[model samples]
Target: MAEPLLDIHGLPGHLIRRLNQIAVAQFMEKMGEIAVDLTPVQYSALCAVKSHPGIDQASIAGLIAYDRATLGKVIDRLEAKGLVSRKVSPQDRRARVVKLTKSGQELLQQVHPVVRAAQGDILTGLDNVEQAQFIALMQKTIQIGNESSRAPQRELGETG
Candidate 1:
């Protein structure tokens, strides 16, 4: 094959996008292997809800660095699947508090190991130490670039 006009192989953004695609594909495949219907975003949202039982939709979006508007649709899907439930927040009725249903909890319990196993596939060629180093470097890069992201992640207790 002829060399491409632009060398995407050397581009961090291109490589990151490709890695993300691989990660998502691997995660979906793992979920499929277990007969679970969950997307990476859905799983992230579910895990966030599990960690923060009364988290609001906006908070979930922030925690997962997902678009808040799109997260509403994701929450709707999870709700339809009986994985999560939303209720009017007592403190702020305008905001909806999300909590995992019993089914959601059980699904997480079953998926945890599968998800862990899928991580290895996502970084297939990397040995354990390399994987750790790669992850750490990626995390550092993400932290540095967070402010530039359309949807920046927010830690708990942070208010925008």
Candidate 2:
């Protein structure tokens, strides 16, 4: 057989990225079961708007760690689905403020249980106590990542 690529199970960052891909794929599968048909990013955008009603596109992009251009496209899709509303920001005519519409709120209410079920499926390897700890550890690690994000960074195998 050919050589394994990069020791598939070796690096923490690689494992984390693999896990993210798995999680998002699982999310898509689970959402399909519920007939929601939402991509993971769309769900995140909805949650962000739910948490910050009347927030602007740039802020939402930052909140979701999405580039503005991509998030604008996401907003366009959401608007088409009637799950989100956008209005020109009164204070900044150049900006668009976003909010979830009633349908969006209802959709969120339906999605929470589905998402929780999906989370359980994602962490089925862990017991309840381990799941809690895993979540806490993930939160801690993600915070650290956010803090270090502003500094110079390199790709996993970059020569620099």
Candidate 3:
């Protein structure tokens, strides 16, 4: 008997998608426990802005591997939350530069430990060594397949 395609247990894409869902759920649950109201993408944006203060919105999209157009909405939400501030870029008047505000920095610091702890739950069945190996493998796979993604991650200094 031919195996059913609907049985996606052995499929990498299906597995990866499931893992992503689990990761996001764990992240949101942990954040909720800590009383922090931030999505994974928003948290990534905050980290990117913190790392490269005054970076343009397009660069942030690249850094975080998020769709550039959609990132605008994400930034708007962050701005509305008073976590980040956006200003017209000095070098490019048309571009908006983003910076994490004091509140954003403080919230990030407060939630850092919670976020780190939440990582363990994402791969709950994996032990310490297995988790490290899985992470390394995932990184390598992502690096190899990055260019194939609709929103591929790019180095901060890389130009399109």
Candidate 1 segments whose C-alpha is farther than 4 A from its true place: 1-6
**lDDT (Cα, tens digit) per residue for candidate 3, span 1-160:** 9866687888999999999999899889888888889999999999999999999999999999999999999999999999999999989999999999999999999987888878888898899999999999999999999999999999887966
* Candidate 2: segments with Cα more than 4 A from true spot: 1-6, 147-160
Which model scores highest in lDDT? 3
**Local distance difference test, each candidate:** 0.92, 0.83, 0.93
Q: How close is candidate 3 to the true structure, as a TM-score?
A: 0.94
lDDT of 2 by residue, 1-160 (tens): 9777777679888888888889999998888888897888899889989988998887777776666788899999999999999999999999999999999999999997888777877787899999999999988887668635532222222221
Comparing 1 with 2 on TM-score, the higher-scoring candidate is 1
Q: What would you estimate as the lDDT of candidate 2?
A: 0.83
Return the TM-score for candidate 1, rounded to 2 decimals. 0.95
What is the total number of backbone clashes in candidate 2? Answer: 0
**Which has the better TM-score: candidate 2, or candidate 3?**
3
Clash number for each model: 0, 0, 0
Worst 10 residues of 3 by lDDT: 2-11
